[model samples]
Target: MRRKSLSTGDLARYCQVTPATIVNWIRAGKLDVYTTPGGQYRMELPKFIAFLEDNEFPIPEELQADRTRKILIVDDEEEILDLLVEVVEGSDANYIVRSEKNGYDALIAIGDFKPDIVSIDLNMPKMDGAELVRRLRSNPETKNAKILIVTGMIPTSDLVRKVKRIGVDSFMQKPIDIDEYAKALDKLATFKV
Candidate 1:
């Protein structure tokens, strides 16, 4: 299998440093890097991960290949939640899934799991999805979370506008297509700079 590679910018984000610092590290031989034909520096993912571990640097979620990506699903209907859990857990990609019946519990789970992506129902009871999204956006920890809203509720044009204002990454209708959902999850989890 071809090894994943990261650019200096990607490494900088993981290290919480500027790309210039990454360039300096490469110059100082502190980090291993290779040059493409076009002379862009690239670091092998495995080597970079090992380097971080050896130096006791905090590995960002984007670099945690060993850890299964966590996904949170929130829907008021037990059946829908179960179906989502089944689809995500049965996916080809490694993932750990948690399901909640309402946005309230989903919030608690978010704090606990720090899920990479959240698939939520807009019509959930007890703290609707809109309010939940607002709270997630307000908090620094989850402000950048990727959100996908799945709802059967026919949203009016205004409601769609409202959801856009809250900054959801994607939206899906209820009775979700398993294949489509899986593809979306793969994109979100394997995202690289």
Candidate 2:
């Protein structure tokens, strides 16, 4: 059966949260929402299910899918990369996670695997996160790639403004929280193809 998308109000009622909280989640890159040509927001069913599962919130049995979700992580630090993979693997058996040590390698992998979502580190030995995002955005094939920039650098207000201009899909702090990682992935999965 084909599931229907839900509006913010509908989702709030279903999740037992306020509409304002839903809006905040959307802004925080926790909830995935689609914008119509007229700029109205709606949530996709599969992504909503993923969000619920990631948060340990209850989900209707019928809403669960059999297939695994694919994810890619790009980072220079081996420890962090491994840790991210471990967390995702432990969270759900249905997640296929892969990692790359640098942005250049990650780009190459993306072309072949075509992951549902990607998490990238802002600093690396080769290409940095900002430049990687620019390149991805410029390319027709990867223009719609869902990218989350994870960084440890403490940025000034000016730097934050500049980072926002890069057009990254989301941003997270370093030493990633497991729940937050899952939430970001769930949100990215909600994006319309």
Per TM-score, the best of the predicted structures is 1
TM-scores of the candidates are 0.67, 0.61
**lDDT of each residue in 70-179, candidate 2, tens digit only:** 78898999999988888778775467889999989988998887666678887787887777777887876666667887888765544445666978788888778878
Task: Evaluate all candidate structures by whole-model CA lDDT and list the values in order.
Answer: 0.83, 0.77
- Please give the lDDT score for candidate 1: 0.83
* RMSD of candidate 1 to true structure, Å: 8.3
Deviation of model 2 at 106, angstroms: 1.0
lDDT for predicted candidate 2 compared with the true structure: 0.77
Cand. 2 TM to true fold: 0.61
Worst 10 contiguous positions by lDDT, candidate 1 = 59-68
